[model samples]
Target: MLSKEEIQRYQRHFPLPDFGVEAQEKLKKSKVLIVGCGGLGNPVSSYLAASGVSCIGLIDSDVVSISNLQRQILYKEQEIGISKVRLTAQKLKELNHHVEIEEYNLNLNSKNALSIIDKFDLVIDCTDNFPTRYLINDACILQNKPFIYGSIYQYEGQVAVFNVNKSANYRDLYPTPPNPESVPDCEIGGVLGTLPGIIGSIQANEAIKVICGIGQPLIEKLFIFDSQSMETRVIKIKNTNARDTITGLIDYEEFCHPNKNKMVKEITVKELHEMIENKEDFQLIDVREPHEVEIATLDGELIPLGDIPQNEDKIAKNKKVVVHCRSGARSGQAIQYLQGKLGLENLYNLKGGILAWADEIDPSMEKY
Candidate 1:
């Protein structure tokens, strides 16, 4: 039931023998939910909308930043300080107004995963952390929905399809999440800006195949790509005993490794405000780039996360150093870095990062 204009808009795709008006219509009818609108989510969500997916739900608890402009193609410099979901929704609608786009500006957690996945036909896990990935996997399995998973580290990326029609799941491949400290992020390890783009596009293609019901889906197979060597390899995964243990969606973080994250140095938003008021003899350091401070807070010292190791001498080892970034993600790494280098036991992370401070303490402060 595409109108004359709709047919004209997608004329290029309709003529393809394998993907004609019927496949396009199927795409127009399918609902795909994308989690974590950051690196992989940005490209995956954009292409799905441009390809005419009828309903694309984006779930993210992040905002646009200047640093993200390098790879997250959907955002622009002007959109800095805006919610990732808000800006992404506006742009995707402009690209293809024919589709429906839903935005959730809240973080994904065990409490709301089921209700969220229940609304979409398939879920795409573009999240960066292991805890969130495991949560998405368990939710998809519990809801009996297929999920496309994508992850990138430095110059390498991995993509796979899981929990489709009771097929092999994430747990079937990796029984437990890696130790949080053991896995370094793109921020610390440095990822190629174009890495997620390549991986996310593949994820979008997998979702289209899942919806069109054509081509062999990447079931029980994990595809790994290395941009440096320009090589692609697929690892075949066999069913594991972990499948039998997952009767229902249990706590993913605890299931991964209980008490492992108990040592994470975190403080509540309230605790931070109290420190600022009491004028506690502590340095509230903002580890994001200098440009990021123009849009966000604590207005503290600017030592980008990348330069932490070299700039340790600049930090006050005697006084408490309360470190933070856009979200609490980078600060945790920063605290860990300092502890290992200077053994600064007084180092603390601004819990939930500056975002929590913006939400709880100072709403007037721009959230970027």
Candidate 2:
């Protein structure tokens, strides 16, 4: 059913033995939903569009920031502060006018996950956090759609095919979410710029293989790659009874963060500024990495989040202690650990971390 121009455009694909006009036509009929428009989303969407995927659905609420330029290749410096899904949709349309692009400039949560995913033929997990990943897994399973999973950490990345033919899903690999504090995202733990490109391409390839019904897709197997060593390995996943437990979607955030009910106390940057102006007797702790301190700092004692366990004595017990990071996420994690493990009652999280201080208190300070 391809037009003459379409045949000529994808003529290169017509010569392959198994993947010829038929497979290309299959691609032209497939609908894919990519969750998260960050590093992994960039290459996955690009290649799938270029390969003639009929429709692509992009869902992400985050805006482009300076920190994303390192791995998110689809964005430019000029596009900073713009919606990521909207910009990515425009770029993909420019790449292939034959493909349809759907943009949802909103975060994917339990309330919207099932409805949105049910419209697509398949889903791709490009998210960086555990809660969203679990949300995608459950939704895709409920909709009876397969999903491709990809994740990058520092120099290592992982890719896997889940829920194809009712096979193993994410929960089959990870029965429960890990402690949030133990896992650091790309912002806290740096990722090589080229890592996502490699892993995402593999994910896109798996999607094509599944759609076209051609070669062996990575069903029930996880692909691990290390860019630093140029090494690769595949681990076979055993299907479990976990799928029986997923009858409906629940609150993923509360599920992943078991200590959500035990809220941490927070102090605004203005309040901290007032305290500093008043010469209050309080301890300020920086929980960011050493390299981050070099860029910008609040002159607080350097105790990175990882080192808090060993240096618990350094945090003053008698004085009010304020913990901060680039944003408040890591600092909140630090305070949670300090309070839950050390039973410290004097800890407080600096709201919005150093970025807020740079914006409100010290306008001259640099922000990452």
Candidate 3:
């Protein structure tokens, strides 16, 4: 029962063969849960809201930063430090008042993944990390809810529909997560501002098709788009039967990364600050980008996450090495690589990276 305003707002879609009031009513009755409110999530939620999806759940554990303004089109510089989920919900409401926005300012981990995912009819995997992707895939399969998956690298991106019609899923595409150090994220190697826009729009298109069951969805197929070459390819996704082995939600972090249980030392910002005060003999490594160093930096050598392999000699062999980034994710990855691959042991990750330093040690320093 869409209102008069809703009818006029979605008038453009009424021209489809069978997508008039009947499809609009189906859209109004559907519920979707978008796992991430960044890059792809921005467009996916925007279109879904305009199409008047009854309930759109937005979940993210990140805050808006000036750096995110590049690809995440929904945020502004003024909104920095605010919760992304909250910001996205507010903006979606403005675009379509009739659509309901449910915001969760929390990360999706093994503990809450299944229970939360069970509530929605459909799920959209807009997450960036591997652990979370695997968690979403396993949970969706267990709950018998279909999910649309989208992931973007610098210029190339992949999109697919999973668990719908018992089709191939993420596990078929990637049987196991690669080493964290081997894979570089957008933060380490920047993404073109327009890349996510292209991939995200496609993700939204597939989402609508799935919701209405009007068009052929991306079931058992993966769509690959390259912006630089403007090449598009669709590959058949053959199931590895990995879904059969999944009995329940296991530790995703441990599942995605086997080294999670490894003992990796971490030093707190306060401790590092104390070391600074004492003039302790230690080597500080900044695993962030050069531009990130310009934004905010500590007394450390700049060696980006991707360039870690070639710059192995830069790490001091005699002194303790402390790695840091925007958050501890990349830095921890650096420590893992240093120990596992390079066989270096004198390393420690900054507990929470510069964000921790900004909040605890130096409030004047910017936190991005």
Please tell me which predicted candidate would have the highest lDDT against the true structure: 2
Error of 1 at 109 (Å): 1.9
- Model 1 earns a TM-score of 0.81
| lDDT by residue for model 3 (220-239), tens | 99999998899999999998
- Reference-based lDDT, each prediction: 0.84, 0.91, 0.87
lDDT of 2: 0.91
The order by descending lDDT is 2, 3, 1
RMSD of each: 4.0, 2.0, 1.8
Residue 235 local lDDT, model 1: 96
Candidate 2 Cα errors over 4 Å, as ranges: 261-263, 277-279, 357-365
Clashing pairs in 1: none
Q: What is the TM-score of each candidate against the true structure?
A: 0.81, 0.94, 0.95
How well is each residue in 95-197 modelled by candidate 2, as lDDT tens digits? 9999999899999988888889988999999999999999999998888899999999999999999998899999999999998878878877789998999
What local lDDT does model 3 show for residue 212? Answer: 87
Off by over 4 Å in 1: 265-327, 330-347, 352-368
